[model samples]
Target: MRFVPRPALAAIAALLLLASGCDLLSAEAEVYDSPLSADDRRAPGPSYLQMPVRQQGGAVLHTPSGTRVVRGAYDWWTRDGDLVTAAAGGLLLYGADGQDGRVKDRGLNPDQTGSTGEAISALHYSDRFRIDVFSPDLADRRTIVVPASAFDTDQASGSGAELQLHGDPYTLDGVTWVEWGVNSEDDTLTDHGLFRIEGDQIDGVLRNEPIVRLYPAYDGSALMLLRQDNGEDEDCGGCVVEQDLVELDPETGEVAAEYGMPPGYDRDWRVDAVDKVGDTVAVRFRVYDGEGRDATAQWQLWTYDGEWAEREELAGVRVWFQDGGRLVERPTDPAGSPSTSAGAYPATLTWVPGETGDLSDGEADGEVDGEVLFEPSGATCRLGRGEEFCPQLSTTGSLLPRE
Candidate 1:
C-alpha cells in the first residue's frame, strides 16, 4: 500500500463540494483554475468483461508431431494406436479401411451417446475393455468382463455369434474374444461382433454401430472420468441435479473407485474453457449466495493443481464490480469445474494520465513542479514538482502488492 498526503487535494475537494450544486460537466474547464477535482474521477463507461473466446478440443493423445487423431467419445481409447480406419481417408479420422480390409470410422463424436450434456469415453487397460458413460445429469455406467464361471452354456454355443466371447474351452489361439450375439434369422441383426483385445486399442466389428471415444493422455496409466454438473433444471420432485466430479484410474481396473463430487455451486463454473495455458485448474463457483428470491449466488473463482493429487484452500471471497460482472475467489480449490463460456480471471487496470510531449525537458514526464504529494499509499515515487500543475507517474516499480 502507498501513503499519499492529500493536503492540496483536500482544498480542491472542498471546492468541488461547494460547487456540487452545479452541473459537474458544464462547470469543468478550469474549476476555478484548479485541477484537484480532476483526480480519481472516471468517465462512466464499462467493466469490459472477458470477451467470448472460442474453445478448441484437442486430439486424443497429442504428440509432438501434432494430434495424430482428434479424440472423440465412443464406448473405446487405448494405448492410442494410430488405426488406419480407411484406405482412402488420410487417417481413420476421416474414415478408414485397413490394408488388410478391416474398416472403422475415426470421426469425433461429442453426441454419439443420445443425450445432451452426455459424453461417452473408452479405456483399454491390461486386457479388459472399460467404457465410461458420463451424463451431466446422472450416475455413469461401468461394465467389466464377465468371469469365466459366470459364462452361460448357451454363450459357449455362440448362438447369436456376435464374435462369441467364451472363457471356457480354450481355443487353439490363446487370445480371448468378446463375440457378437446375432439372432438365428439371417435377416435380423443380433449383437455387436467379438473383438480381439490387443495391448491397448481394441479391434472389434459390430453388426450395429458401437460408440467410440478417444483420449489424448497416452502412458495414461489410469483412466479418469471428470464430470461437471451445470446444475441444470430438475423436474418433478427433484431439485437442481447435483453435479459430480470423478477420476478413474484404469491402471488397476478398479471398478466403482473414483473421486466423489462435492456439493454446492454457482456461476463462473468453468475449466480449461478458453486457452490451454496455466497449470492451475481454475474453477469459479458461488461462495456466498446473497439473500434474494432466488437461492443462486454470484459466481466465484479459484485455481487448483490439475495433477489429481490434493491441495488446501488458502483464502476466498465474493466480490462484485457494481459495473457489470461479479467475481468469487477460493485460492486452493481442486479443478473439476463444469463447462462454461464465461471467464474466471480478472482483468488488468491501468492508470495513464496526460498525453505524450507534455514534458518541458527531453525527459519522461511524470510530475509538474514542487506540488508533488503522495497518494494514500506511499508506494509510488512522483517526479517533477509544481505549484498547481503537478502530474503523477503510476506506481510500476518495486511497490506494495494488491490483495
Candidate 2:
C-alpha cells in the first residue's frame, strides 16, 4: 500500500462524500422528470382563505403573486376565482387580472350579499325591493325586483307590510331562489314564501309554509324544508314546536316526503342545519336549558339521507359547509365555543367530493383528513404608538381559496 498523510486521506474521503451527494441529487432530479400524467400532477400553489378582519374594514387577499389588502371592504365572499366585496363605498368585484368590475357605486355597502362558489352572487336590498345578481366571476350583472305585492296577504298589504329577506339568496338546479317574509308592524313574521327569480322577474314557489330553513338536496332531486309542526290549529303564538325535515317538489313546491324527528326533539333543543355534503346533509342538534343556556354536554355529527344517522369519526367536532360542496371541520372546544368567533383555534378543513342530481339511496364516505389551513389570531392591529393604526385583522369562516 502506498504511504499517505492522514490529512490527505481525510480530505479525499470528504470529496468522495460530496460527489456521492451530487449523484443522489441527480438521481432525484431524474425521478422527478419521469413523465407524470396531467391528472396525477398536483395544483401549482398553496390554497389560501380570505378571512374577514372582524373589527376592521378591509379584506386580506392572497394571490399567487403575494398577499394584498382590499381596503374599505366590510365583508367579502368568493365566486369562481373572483372576489365579491362589500365596502363602505359600495359592492365591488375583483377579477383575476386585478380589474375592478364595479357596476357603478350602489351607495354604501348593500344590506347583504352572499354566494356559494357554485351559485350566483346576490346583493339583496329589501328596502329597495331589488336584488342584483352576478355571475360566478362577478360579471354579467342582472337586477331583479321583488314587488311589494309579491308578499301581499289578507293582514299585510300596501304600506303596513314590512318586507324582510329571511336568508341570503341560493341557487338550486340552475334556478335562483330567495326567501321573503312579511313582518307585522310589531316585527313578528306573519307570512313567508320561497320565491324564484328568472331574468328580471320573480315568482313564489312555496308560500306561508312555516319553514324555518330550506336546502336543496345534494342531488337536486327534492327541496328539503325544515318546518315547524304546531298541533291542530293551536295558537301557540310563536312558541317553538317540534320540527320535521320534509322533501318538497322542486318545481311544484309541494311536500313530497316527511322525515319526522323524535318526540321532544324541539322541547328545548335547536338544530343548526348545515348544508349538504356529498350524498348526506350534516346537521348539528344542540340542547339548551329552560333558561335558554347551552346545555349541550356533547357534540355530534348527524347526517340525513333518507333518515338521520350519527357519524362516528367526526363526533365532537363542528362542521361548516364551505362553497363548492366542501365541509370545514374543527374540533369542538371543551368550553363549548364556536370557531366562527374571534380567537385562535385548530381547524381541519376537508373538501368532500360532490355529486350531481338525486342520489337519495347512495352512500357517502366520511371526510378525508386535511391539513390545518390557518389558525385565527383574532382581530390584531398595530401596537406602535405613533403608527397610523391598521385595521384590526381577524379570521372569518368565509375562506377564499387560493387566487
Candidate 3:
C-alpha cells in the first residue's frame, strides 16, 4: 500500500472524522499503563481464566505448549502446563523458564490485529489510519499511514460515516495484507477490498468486492470468501446467502482454487471458518433447516486437498487449529451444543502444541489416532477418560450449551 505524507494524511483524516460526527479522537494519543497489581498473581482455579461470557471479540495466539487468549481491548491470558496467568494490556512474552509476562503498555490500542509466524500487526484508526507492525517481543518495527479517502466511506445516512477493517490482517511470504470496507447504515451498498502492504505502499488485489472475508493459507496463499449477489429470490420465503471461497496466491494474486456451496444447500448455509492443516483445508459451515420462525441448525466440516476438485464433509465434529498446521476434532452433540442451535459457539478452542502428532495423513481417509490435551470445565470438575481413538475431556456443564 502507498501512503501519502503523514501531515497531509492527518489533515484528511480529521476532516473525514468531523464530517462523520466521530468525536472520539483526542488531540494527542493517550498512553496506557500496565494494569497488573501486586495481588495479580497466579490464583488457584482453572488453568486458564474464562473470559467474560459476553466479551467474545478477541484473537487467539497459538503457542508452543498451549494457546494464548487476548480478550477485548488489552486483557490477555495464557496457559502453561497446569497454570494460567492473567495480565493487562501490553506485549505478551514467554520466558525461557516456561513462564509468561506482559511488557509495560506503550499506549497503543488497535482496532484490528493479525499475525504471521512470530510477527503481529495492529491497525489503529484516528484522523489518519495507521498500521503498526511489531516483533514477537512487542518492539515496534514499522508504521504505515493511509489517507481516509482510501477507505471511501459513504455519508448517505445521518449516522457517522466511517471506515471498518474486517477480520485480522495477514502476513505471509514477506508481505502483509488486510481487508477493509466502508459501511453506512442508510445505504445498502458497501465497498471492500483486499490490499497488499509493502512498506508504506499498498496495492489492491481484489478491489470493490461486496462483503469479502480473507483467511491465510498454510502455504503463504490466501482464501478469499466473497458473498455473491444472487439477485432477489421471489420463490424462497427466507433464505441465507452463500459465499464463494477462492484460494489466491499471495505473491501473484492469482486464483489457485475455488469452491462453492453444494447445489441444494446454498440457500440456507453459511461459512463459519476456514482453516488449513498441512496440505488439507477445512471449511466449516452452519446449515439451517427451516425458515425464520422454526429454523434448526447444525455444523459441518468440509475438507479439501489442492488437487481434488471435490471436498469431503466431516460429519458431527467440531475442529480447532493447532500450532503446526494440525487440526483437532471433537464430537458435537446436536441436542446440547450452542453452535448447533444459535449459529455461534461461546468458547474458543486452541490445541496444546506438541501434545499430539499430525493426523493430516489419515484425516483424508477418515481414520486417525490422537489425544485431547485440553479439557473444558467449571470451577471444580473431574478430568475425563480417553476413548479408543479419540480422548475425552470432562466438564461440569457443557462448555458450549444450547441457547
Candidate 4:
C-alpha cells in the first residue's frame, strides 16, 4: 500500500501523478455507479468536538467519558458516531452501531482519502486503478476503475505517476464527480483535473487545467474554483500569480460565474478556507511576499458580494470552520503569542464571525471577536461534563465534529 502523508494544520499536498504524456481516458475504463439513495445519505447523529491526542496517535471522542476510537490512526472522521479511518491496514470504519465493531473495511492499498462532510472517497492503487466512494452511513459503495495505461507512469518525470483526489466526491444532477490533480514529485507545481463516474461512462474530465483548488460552494449550490493562468511568470520570480474565483458548472465542466476579489488581492494570495454568509462568500487567505513567503502569520478573511460587485476585508480575525450556522474564530491579537497566561499552552478560542451585515463600515465587529473555549493547564485539557483529553502541542490536533 502506497501512502502519502500530508502536512499539519493546512495545505493538503496531494499525491503526484505522472505527466510525460497526456491523453483522454481510453474506452477500456469501467465505471459502476451505485448511487446513494436518500435513506443512505441520512443526517448524522449528535456530534461532539473530537481532537487527536498528540504522541498517542489515537483521538479522544469528546463524549461524556471521552471515548477513544481508531487506535494508531490520526487520519479519521466521524459519521453517525462511527469512525472512518485511513490507516496502514486500509480504509476502515470502526463503530458500535448495528454492527459489533468494524462495519466496513475496503481497499488493498493504503488509500488516499477525503470527505465532503457527508461521504468518503478514496483513490486506490496497486490492486486496481480505481476510485472508491463510500456513503455517509457506510451502507453503499461505488467503484470506478480505469485502465492502467491511462496513468502512463512510465512518462512521469519524478516519483512515478500517482492519482491525487482533491477534496472529496460531489454530486451534481444525480451524478458524482471527484476533482483530482497531478503534482510534481516535490509538490511545487500541480495540474488540476476532474474525474467522475456517471452511468456507464467513466471519464477524466477537465484534464490538466490550471485550476489549483476546487471546493464546494459554502452554500452547496455550486463549485468554487481558484484558477491560475497557464502562462509562465518570468517577471515576478514566483512572487505573484494571477488567480480568479469562479463558480463551476459541474454538468458542463465550465465556469458558470465569476466572483470578484477585492482590489489589489487578485494575485499573490493563497486561499486558506472559504464559506458563505447570507449573500456573500467568505474567503480566508494568506498574502505572500516577493520571496513567496506568507506576509503575515494570521489568515485574512474577506467577503465578496454574490453579485460579483462589492467586497470587504475583515481585519485582525482568523476563522475556522462554520458549524451550526456560526463561524468559529481563533484570535491573534498579540501576534506570535499563543497564550498570555504564564506556563499555559495555546488555547482554541471559539467565537462567531460577528453579524452578517455591512462589513466595510466596520459594523462586523463581532466577526473579529471570540471567547476562549478551553484552556490547557498542563498536558491534559479539561472540558465540561468532566471530559478531558491530553493533546500534544507539537501536532496541535484539529477540532472535528463527531458523535
Candidate 5:
C-alpha cells in the first residue's frame, strides 16, 4: 500500500485550488473575517492580586466540614432570591436552593440587613473572583453592600498591546479570551500562591501567586481548576488556566493527547474556548478584504489537525516576519467534511494586503519600491517572499470555504 502524509496531501490539494487566483474575503463577507477598526486594541490585565474579595460587614467565617444539617429548618431559598436564615445542625445558616433543588450553604451574618433593590443577583455569581454578599434582604431585594471581583484593574483604561481580562472582546483584535479559575486548590481571598493539584494530589514548583488569573480552558468539566502560575519567572510564567489544547480525561483529570496547530503559535491564540467537533476545533477570524469589485470584507478560519501531537509543528515559515498567523477554524462532524486522506485538505485562498505581488508600474500610493512580493524583509519577487501561503492576483470569483 502506498502511504502519503495526510497533511502534505491536504496542503497540495489546497495549493491547486488556492493558487488559481480568486477574489478574497472581507470581514463582513460570507467567509467572515472579524471586522476590526483602528479603535480595537487592549492591554494586559493586572498582573495578580493577593485577595480580590473582602468579607462583608457583620460576617463570620465558618467551614462546612464542621456542619451536619439534615432537613428540618435548613437554610433554604430559591436561586433567584435573597438568602434566608434557619437554625440547623448546631448552627445558624444562610443560603439558597438552586433551581436544581441543591441547597447552597453560606455562613451567617449577625447584623445582616438591607433595603430596596439591594440583594445579590444569582446570575452575577462567579466562583473565580470573590463576592462578598453582606446584609442581604429578601423583602427589599437589595442590600447594603455587594462587591464582586474580576481580575481586571482599570476597567476603562488600556492600550492595544496587552490583553485585558474584561470588557469589549471585539475591540481587541489579537486578544484571546479567558475565564476565572475555581476549584479545591483554595484560591481563597487571602491565600495567594501557585500550586497544582492532579486528581486529589497537589504538587509542583511553588511561587508567590497573583490575586486572580483567567482560565477559560476549564469551561465546564470535572477537570476544572485555575492553574495559577508564578506569572513572572520562566517556569511559572503561565497564567491561571485549566487546560490548553492538551486534553485531559474528563473523569480522571489524567494527561490526554495534545492537539496539533500550525507551528510557532503560542497558547495565547485561545482555541479551546471555541466550539469543537470531536477532535477537530474550528476558529472564527476577521477577514479584512472581500471578493468582487464592490468587495470590502474579510473572512478567516483556523482548523486543528486532530491527529498531530502539536500544532506548532505546522507553523508556516516566516518570510522576514510581521505580526503572526491565525488558527481560525475547527471542523465539525467528521463525516460532514471531506476525507483528510490523499488529495483533500482544508485551506484558504486569500488576497493579503501587506504581501501583494506583481506590481510593475512603479508601485501604487502605499505600495513600496521594487517589490513584487512584500514581506517583513521588504519587497521581493523571490519564490518564498511574504507571510501569505500564496500570491495575490485574483482574476476570478471570491475564495470560498473548502477542504
Candidate 6:
C-alpha cells in the first residue's frame, strides 16, 4: 500500500467525529426538553361539555340560566319547572335550571314509563305484567301486577290479531295509564283504548276510540288527536274525511278543550308534530293536494297560547320554541350559504342569559339575536356586520383558513 499523508488522514477523522458529536448533542437536547408532558401529570379540565339529552323532534328543554345536566337516553317529562326522565335501566330527577341532578338505577325494569309531580311509574313485562311506582329519587313505593288478557284486543275489520300495548305509559294525579291497540301486526292503528292503574289495582278499559295520537298536557290532561272514519271517499279514493283534536280531563274522561282546523284547511291537512311549553301548544301540519297526495312543500305551523291562535306558512324551514314561549324560524336548505342566508348546519335558537353589547339598550331578554347567539340548529355562533359566523378551529386548536 502507498504511504498516506498523516495530516490528511487526521483531518478526515476529525470531520467524522465532529459530525457524530453534533448528532449526539441534538438528540440529547431533544430528550431533555421534549414538548410532551409526563404520563402522571394532571389533565386540564374540559372547555365545554356536550348536553346529554337529545331533543325529540321539536321538543326542547328550557333551562333556567345555567348549564343543563342529564343522564342516560330516556323519555323526558316536565311539570311546574321540574324535569323527569325514565329508561329501561333507571330514572333521572333534575330541575328545569339543571340543578340537583340525581339518578337511580336499582330495581327499575321499565318497558314503558312515565312521571308525574308526585311519582314515577313504569310497566315491567315478565311472565305477566307489572306496574311499579317509585319516588322521584327512585325509591320503591308500590307495585301492581295485572293479567295480559285484561286489555281489549278488538281487531280491525280485515286485519289480524290485536297487539297488547301500543304506546308508552303516562301518569296523571296518582294514576298510570297506557294505550292498547289492535292491528299492530300490520303496523297500522285500527282500534285503541286506555287502561288505568292506581296503587295495587288495575281498572278496566277507561275509554275506547280511534285515537291517532296522544300527548300529555302540563296540567295532567290528555290531548287526543282523533281521526274520524267516514269510509273511503268515492270521488277521492284515499282522502280523510275529518279529524279532531280534543283535550280530555284525566279524571272525568270528558272533553276539556277542542281545536278545529283553521278556516281554509280541510280534513285533508294532517298534523306532523306537536310540542307544548307551559300552557302554549305548537302544532305543525302539512297540506294535501286535491288528488289526496301530500304537498310536502307546503308546511303550516300554528301556536295556541290559550287566548288566540297564530299561523304561519313555512317552506323548507324549521321552527322551534325558546324558554318564554317564543317561536324561532330558520331555513333548512343546504344549498343556501351559511352566515349569509340560513345559519350553519344543525342551526338552532339559543337563549343567552346576559347582555349582548350590540343591543342599543343593554338588556337581556334571554333570547338569541344572532349577534350573540344562533337558532334552529342550536349551535352557538357570532353575528357581525349583518353576517353570522361560527367558530372554526383546526385540529391543533388554530383558526382554520378563511377567505
- Candidate number achieving the greatest lDDT relative to the actual structure: 2
lDDT of each: 0.24, 0.48, 0.44, 0.44, 0.23, 0.43
Model 5 lDDT-worst window of ten: 43-52
Clashes of 3: 4
Per-residue lDDT over 173-266 for candidate 6, one digit per residue giving the tens place of the 0 to 100 score? 6667676655444534445567766665566553455455565532332344443433222334344666645445455444444444444556
Model 6, CA-based lDDT: 0.43
Tell me how far the alpha carbon of residue 111 in candidate 4 is from the true structure, in angstroms, after superposition: 4.1
Q: For all candidates, what are the clash counts?
A: 44, 2, 4, 5, 47, 10
Let me know the TM-score candidate 5 reaches against the reference structure.
0.22
| Candidate ranking (TM-score, best to worst) | 2, 4, 3, 6, 1, 5
Better of 4 and 6 by TM-score: 4
Pairs that collide, model 2 = 50-400, 219-357
Residue 357 displacement (Å), model 6: 25
Off by over 4 Å in 3: 1-88, 94-97, 103-105, 125-128, 149-166, 218-223, 229-239, 252-257, 276-280, 291-295, 306-313, 321-332, 335-403
Every model's TM-score: 0.23, 0.62, 0.59, 0.60, 0.22, 0.52
- Report model 1's TM-score to 2 decimal places: 0.23
Top-scoring candidate (TM-score): 2
Error of 4 at 74 (Å): 4.1
| Candidate 2, 90-200: lDDT as tens digits | 666655345566656565466655554444546555454666666655546666777777764555645576676656666655566778877665544466788876655
Q: How far is candidate 1 from the true structure (C-alpha RMSD, Å)?
A: 26.2
Better of 1 and 3 by lDDT: 3
